[model samples]
Target: MRRSRLGRFGSRLQSRSWPRFVPRFVPRFLRCLWPDTLFGRLVMILAIGMFAGQVLTSTIWFDTHESRTLEVPARLFASRLADTARLIALAPDDAARRALAQQLGDPKYQIAWIAAKAPGVDATSTAGFRREPIVQRVIGDLIRGVLARRLGAPPEIRLLEANVHDDSGKRGGILNLFDSPMPTGDFHVQLKLHGTGWSGWLDVRANEGQADALTEPHSLALDYLVRIYLIRFTAVCVLAFIAVRFAVQPLRQLAKAAEALGRNIHRPPLPVTGPSEVRSAAQSFNAMQQQLADSIAQRTRFLTAVSHDLRSPLTRLRLRAEMLPDPVWRERLRGDLDEMEAMVTSTLDAVQGIEITETRHEIDLDSMLEGLAQDLREAGHAVSIAGRAGRPVPGYPRNLKRCLQNLLDNAVRYGERADVQITDTGRSVRIVISDRGPGIADAALRERVFEPYVRLASKEGTGLGLTISRSIAAAHGGTLTLENRAERGLDAVLSLPRED
Candidate 1:
């Protein structure tokens, strides 16, 4: 029943980033112990609650446990006294009474006859006492009280005047000191016994674990308490971890699907399963992903249709340019026609980048860059590769090559030179392409340049290059960002995760 409630509770909690009830200004040490992950935090909260409950239960019941521990042995000792008195009463004389005392004595106790002493008790010691004198007093009282009831009369039951030999209890002993009736010291008891024409003292020293708490010290009590708590604490942690992890699994899957959605707009829809809340979330997510896919598909089709329709006219224009009478006129007309055609081609390419059809594979990035540099050199463009690309990146090989080509070509066109640097780490591979040109001083314009068809007045080409490059990078689960170099250039930093 509790598990069902926890599952429902976690369903609501899983959707939130942080619980509002949790205070923001937790102590630094406590914050350090707190986990960063959602799953860990949930488990930690559950474990703490369970551990506190166990501690509380131990405290509430301990008084009862302590009383029971002290009473059982105490009653048995009183019973032994009652039995001894009855046997002494049946004895014929003092000689038989003395013999009975020595007959049933154990190694831990000394039972012998002495002259009958006073009726009152003396549980006092001036010094050299570890256990409480009060605990010895309780032992004296319990024994005298129980023994009297069995004998049908109260007798002289006095304790010896000596150093009260005992030690303090282990756990919570001091807390309950004066108020508790439990004995934690031994009994060197001197009591009265009568036989036929014989009267004397039954002097016995009973070393009980409860009376002295000597044989069963407080340290042992502490050990038991600690051991039980540790075992339960461990179990609580383990159980909490398992339960929260299972309950929050669907949430994690939903998050992963959302993250992957941005990378692959056309990827398969999420499975609509699990708890009702999670299933609803998945359905909403899949619907949103479908809407985005349809939007991109419709846009691609529009661009493709426009490009296709313009191709026939572009072909006719090229044919007409071929018939120009003057060479200068023909060349200029041909260049104008070529620029128009390039605009159409770039627009189509930009749309196609969003709908990448190329299969993913591991491409040797260094070799791919070498190929790009070799091609650019043949085309009379100045380009240099300064560092290695380091690792095989999993991506669309053709789309990634095209993306790099556009960035490098822009660098060559504006800056007159391109310099590429590569760096690799466990998480990502970064490629920084630098150019020695006058960088865009306006930060807003630098970002604005990535918008389709937006270009600086002086630039001699369509502004779709960066847009297409960024789209390809996004599709490959990477990023392409521009930074104006400090001294005199612009750097295109392309960072890609090692995995897709």
Candidate 2:
């Protein structure tokens, strides 16, 4: 029987060593940072998105907090400044007005008299109000509004300098990223005041002045920031892990089931549970497995029926041929009947070897190969054995023995001598059987040689030995390949995986 051309092509593609696909522009380090599993990628995306949202919301809250914390202090300061402006209007001279203004201020709220010259540069002159942080902008607007309301008219307020600082003396213009703690805010201002017919800029330095309130909230705010970040991050990560694992576990189980199905036709079907899509996939896989099993059984039954039916007719033909008078005709009939019997037996063996039903066990390859070589040696075949397996392999011993026998027989019959080498490669077991025959010169024929009944020469046997051998190798989850040797003959390499 000839195998399907498409199947042969698929096997060839699988056997050939093609270069793996990789992105040409991506660096190796970046590729390594990328997560390969679904759970990892999903968690990373969720964590990053949550963190970004937290950063945005924290900034808005920080601005609102700055406005509220400074509102009452700003109103009181404006009221005091309004009272001083009226008092200065009552002073008898410029000297007295300056003196009164200087004497009326406190440490936290200082007022001084200054004559306008070039109207000296302020911090905002270079720092630019457009570039003010959200916290600074909010507080500044609130102070200006309160001053205007108290003075009965809008005052020209110039911010000379401003800064916010924490108890640790770390100065910033706003709450740091994600509401880092800050205790106090100080500002220097040059306010334009009009009294009667004279107007001048009053220099003022002031700060938000709740000593106990500011100090107490510093620790509480720090604790709150830390707790919010830590708790939310932990919760998000834990929740993401649980959700992603639950979603991906079904996929992992499905993959393992598919892999195991290739090695065992009788493996149990997948449990149909999970989401609708997952359940549908499991059902489909179970159906495919059943179809494959039923098809194989039908093939086996059909072959058995044909073999049993052909035997009686063949025996009858053989008897009728024996009754013929001519010796040449009698011998011809006998040879034809023998060939027919061999073909049927070889075909059945080929199919049976493809799927072995024996339970796997540890087999000592060293002793098995030595015993096989010894038997062939006693039978007058020039077979040589070398090397060691070193460890036992997990496989069906009888089927394994049959595979080796076919390889050895092919070598001894074609090449006149067979040299077998067994080596344990740590990861796998390699058995190389080299024959001293005219090695197949046509590279194309070497692969097709494994196809059913494919023959390189007119040997006096059914041409199914290599086919049966390769089937046995595949059943054991191993590979059997043929290659031309360097000097002469051919090498048949059988590689069996050592790990699951």
Candidate 3:
């Protein structure tokens, strides 16, 4: 039981701390490699997949083609050399030997003769083909095995020169073989005939051009590289970006709609367009918005009706209080009725404030604040205005005025004075109303005051002022917050987003 408890505790700890822990633990370089946006990450993923596929394809194809390229030429060259040696051994006379060499000779291979004492080099001669140790060794091994079987003895082989020419007087089937159909740099090999005091030379040339990338050095490597790395890879990235952009467009629209709905739940329904999944999401979001608007409307109607019905009863109570015989009793009952009426009126106002029916328009916030300050000053309240918004802000002017007026009233009533300042950023606007009076003692109660009927103990008037102000601010996609001043009093800040 204890072990299980420990496990559960560990799981909860990890779950709670995972978001904070991951960034510190993961390598910074790896984190930097990833892009922040969804589109960039999607493109990166697709590019990686394409690169991997290309590498795999190149590896497999090169392996298969390279084997055939190397071994096929080596095997064919060895077999033809063996056949030449065998025919020379079977010749009955010198004349017949010469004819055999000529008849057996072909475009890729040339038959020839070399004197035993000819002023020429052999396989031990260190030049060209001999300089390439691996190539020489492999060639020697392949030809020797075939020649030894045909000649019934280990044949003496010599790689005279990689590119031999016919400056010598000796002439034969392979003499002046430059005129023959072999490649220019054909390699020469001399095989010793034991019984005969002569040596036979074979000019072996590779029949095919270097075609495989693995076995042969590629001349077009740069071209292939440019085509694959620059052209093909770039094309793939561009296609992926375009495809992902289209895919994410609907998501962007959904997010924008959601933001607008937060400011005003009565926003028009979203269009059911785009792909099937996106259309479905849009339809569902539209339905949710409609449902929320309808619910708020229903509640507002109920509150309005209740307030109206209660007003009639309150009026009758006022009349009955006026008819009371004792003056003190009548005064007390009237006070009670007045309080009841004020509470009902405040509640209804709060409800109606949320159901804004005003059309939006551009209003000069600076002018509005100036007018408010002037009005308060004329009404014998200590109010001053400072700062200016250089531009107009988009909102319902009446609602915004009401929101500011409420805050100003609170500041004047409790704090004894009001200081209003308007700050306008192109994207948003902020109005700060400050006062020098005893702020709420309890920090927790600052937010609670925005709830219906909630008020500070010393403050008089309906508690719905802050609530109604906040509802108006929210309706305009704004916020209202209260903060205690460092020295004394409170600061009520109203922030609203500006129209694009």
Candidate 4:
């Protein structure tokens, strides 16, 4: 049930409108989130880290700039107002005092003044002078209390201010400040005449314009930070991609070489290159392949030479045995010599054929099996072709025919009937031959049953047939397996991969 659900889900996924993009995009995005590949995961981690760092740095910069620009300038404006108040108190006459007040009121200074109290006055009247809106508002309630007693209430309130500076210290523009309503009555103050009779009028209310000096610098910094982040991110990603590709190139080459070896064991050794570790791995693989090839070649050569050398002596022995005087002795000697000769021939053929390089071509397996069956039937053996005829496969036709013949002969000679079946399994072709012969012991099923002189009590003939058949199958990128049928008899299965 679970498998059925999965199959349905797979079908749905594959049938989506943008199916092609799903495979490439989904896996990559998932890898970016929790990457399976080394390069992809590494890049993901680096990208996340860089982005986090940029955010953190930007936050710190904005906080620092806000404090420097807004808070610091607000305090400076308050200090400047105090200084202007002192200058008004020191002026000699009303004209000189008025001149100072006018200078203080200049738009560049952003200052205003209100005179509601005078120096050395009664506390009740002085309270009105201290209620100057612009100065008291800028300083706030607490600081206003301290400054009010120190500066005293003049005739009017004096305020000094200026437009906020941009990052480059240029005025941004006029800024708006809300004014709170003052207490009842427009209280005005007059300076008392000292013994000399000099007096002047004062306006005691004053304030500086609002300015956010920190904002421009903070914004500029953030902009620069964002630009730098973009450039660096791009450059780092490119460099990371290049480095990852370079690092993985050797692995890709190794995979290709491995696939080639699987297809053809005799393929030439791979060229070792890349980093030290990759080069070492390639060198080891090449060495192992060479050693395996050399070992196979050496065994084949040894078997061929031994078989060839034994044949001549066996032939001479058979001739000598025929000359023996006693009939039974001569017959016995002849049988032994013939058996030896047969073993030698089969062994030599199996060994030499294993190493024989043959040109591959397309061959109809069903046609070949039909022909073999016809030949065997004509020779008085009951051989039949079963199952569906499969598609033509590429192989050394003569070699494959010979191998099939050996299997059929074994079945007919021992089991009395041969049944051949051909099947196409998509990736490969399978040819199964079954017979009613008594199968060999299970203990020896995987033994050297293919050895030239080895044979089961219930079977006859030299035992190299299976060996030669398997070698042929292997040469064509396939395998041969032998097993006893569950009910009765033995089965030989030849599986050959489809040619590209």
For model 3, how does the per-residue alpha-carbon lDDT over 15-53 read when each residue is reduced to its tens digit?
Answer: 863333323434565556667777877888788789778
Question: Which model, 2 or 3, shows the larger lDDT?
Answer: 2
**lDDT per residue (tens digit) for residues 397-500 in model 2:** 88889999999888998889999988888778999999988898888899898887878665656778888788777766789999999999999999988765
- Which is the leading candidate under TM-score? 3
CA lDDT scores, all candidates in order = 0.75, 0.75, 0.71, 0.63
Instruction: Tell me the tens digit of each residue's lDDT in model 1 across 300-419.
Output: 889899999999999999999999899999999999999999999977877786566656689889998889988989999888987776668888788899899898988988998999
Across 290-315, the per-residue lDDT of candidate 4 in tens digits comes to: 88778878888888788878878887
Q: lDDT score, residue 422, model 2?
A: 84
Q: What would the TM-score be for candidate 4 when compared with the true structure?
A: 0.51
lDDT of 2 at 80: 69
Q: RMSD of each candidate?
A: 10.3, 9.8, 11.4, 15.2
Candidate 3 Cα misplacement greater than 4 A, ranges: 1-41, 60-226
Which pairs clash inside model 3? Answer: 123-158, 123-159
